[model samples]
Target chain A: MQGTLSVSVWRGGEAGSFQSYEVPRRGNQTVLDVVTYVQRKLDGSLSYRFACRVGMCGSCAMMVNGRPRWTCRTRVSRVASSGKLTIAPLRNLPVIKDLTVDMTDFFDKWAKAGGVFKPTATRAEDFAAIRPTDSKRRHADAGIECIGCGICYAACDVVAWKPGYLGPAALNRAWTLVNDTRDGNGAARLRAVAGDDGCLACHSQQGCQEHCPKHLNPTAAIAGLKRAVAVAALKGRL
Target chain B: MSAEKLQTCLWLVQRISASVLAVAVAVHLITIIAAVQGGLTAAEIIARVGGNGAWAAFYGVFVVAAAVHAPIGVRTVLQEMTPLPNFFVNALSALFGIGLLIMGLDAVSILYRLGGG
Candidate 1:
């Protein structure tokens, strides 16, 4: 890893092509380090987004070689051991610039899936006691750590195939909200996610689960949504 | 019906029909293999199945389950793969299911009537 690495970075809008740049390889280099090298030294005009340079922000996600990955956490030695790398913007979203994608649609779908929590009780009414071992609480806790990184969205085939379909991350958020015992939007949320473009559209491919940096299972969350929708429909609630 | 309810009901119907089909297909395949292995003639097979209420019911259920299952799957594929309108897809899938049901039931009815039932 002592030689200069050949890196091809996407360099424009939707119709742009990859631009090659050579950067000195370091022993413990990340893909973000390569992009930063290109931006700071090789070409000052290159555009990309990253915060915290660690994995927490999830703002540095890009397609590494062909799959959606958080570039900040991905090791160059691990992905591009052959002294070559291809980095591009996340798929299934509009490219804003070189490596930046428009996240408006991603957030819009989250809203459509009722990802927001609807509180049932006021502060004056005292806190709702939810046991840690409660089945519903455990189900909610399982999917509560989503960071809205859009990696799951980028990795979902259903989202790529049907633009109207709410992707895995949005559906996963809805699942967590649905399982919240104190939430007041259960019926409406179930109805929202029961549509043709919602949970039913998922093929259970597990692409989101596989690509998730946090190892979260959006497929399982979507399955939970499907079951909830089915039960609500059967009970005449949806 | 609303699109959400329709989609949910279709999903339920497809799953239930698939369950029925799982058992029916196994039984149908086993019966076919047994008949072929025992060297039963077409006429002899007809004699055994024709006018038999139990066999008629079994085949009837099998045909119904297949009629329900295949068309829903086809509808999903059309919706996802093709650029067709939703209304057109629904109508086309419904017609396909109806056609299957009619043809399958007709075949079963003819077999039932062949032995004077």
Candidate 2:
């Protein structure tokens, strides 16, 4: 914590190399602080994305030492124990610049996976009282906190292997909707997540669950989708 | 069938067949171990299993489970690993499943016939 840390940051687009920059290490320093220092002081052209310095905004996530992590919450002392840090754009995504990735496909897949909620009742209808202790509500609550962070998406090998496959975050969103008692899109949602590119495509690797900064389990959500799909198929509703 | 329905059905088939294979494999392994431990010779084993209806039925179910389970697994691997067209992958998977079924049933038939049926 008293010495300069050797930080290797990625520069350029699809074709690029790691540019090493030495930064003064301090106690309680986050990886985001290191990147900010490099961009502000060392190099003004260094490109990255971050809104809140805290972990609320998922935009600060990047590949920290070959793992997708929210850099704002990731302490340098914990990650770079060897006094060396390798920071790069998130994997399984298109790199736009140094540390920023093109998130078009990531969010697009979320829509494709039926992550959008449909209303069963019109605005004139009375509010559907869903108790917090309800099993379905509880199930929905478990995965509803996801802030569209691509950490799970980047961590997924299935996403890396099959580009069309709906990644974990999207499926996790779908799961939350599936458990929503007021949601009107149950049948369509099941259909959307049924095929090879949907829930069935998940290899249950739990990479999404493993790296989720929100501590959500997309794997379990996907498994739930699989069961729902199977039930629908059996009931001739799919 | 629609692609979604077909994929879901295939997933169901794989899961069901895998369950069957799980039981079949356990039974097969246990039988092998028991036979070996009992000091049964090749001829003695054949004498007990060749003409036995129960053994034939068990093995017949085992072979079917394996045939169903393996081809689906093979199809998944081919689809994920190769850049093959979906049509070609489906065709190859179907052919593979048929081949496994034919070969498996044939082997079972031979064993059944060894009992002079």
TM-score for chain B of all predictions: 0.91, 0.90
Candidate 1: tens digits of C-alpha lDDT, residues A6-78: 9999999999999998999998999999999999998989989999886887789999999999998999999
Lowest summed lDDT over 10 consecutive residues: which window, candidate 2 chain A?
A: A51-60
On residues B1-117, what C-alpha lDDT tens digit does candidate 1 reach at each position?
Answer: 777997899999899999999999999989888777557686777787989989999999999999999999999888989999989999999999999999999999989989568
lDDT of each: 0.91, 0.91
RMSD of each candidate? 1.7, 1.4
Instruction: Evaluate model 2: give its lDDT.
Output: 0.91
True lDDT of residue B21, candidate 1 = 96
The true-versus-predicted C-alpha distance at residue A16 of model 2, in Å, is: 0.9
Clashing pairs in 1: none
Model 1 per-residue lDDT at B24: 97
* Residue-by-residue lDDT tens digits, candidate 2, B18-102: 9998888888888788777557676666776887788888888888888888888888888888899888988899899899899
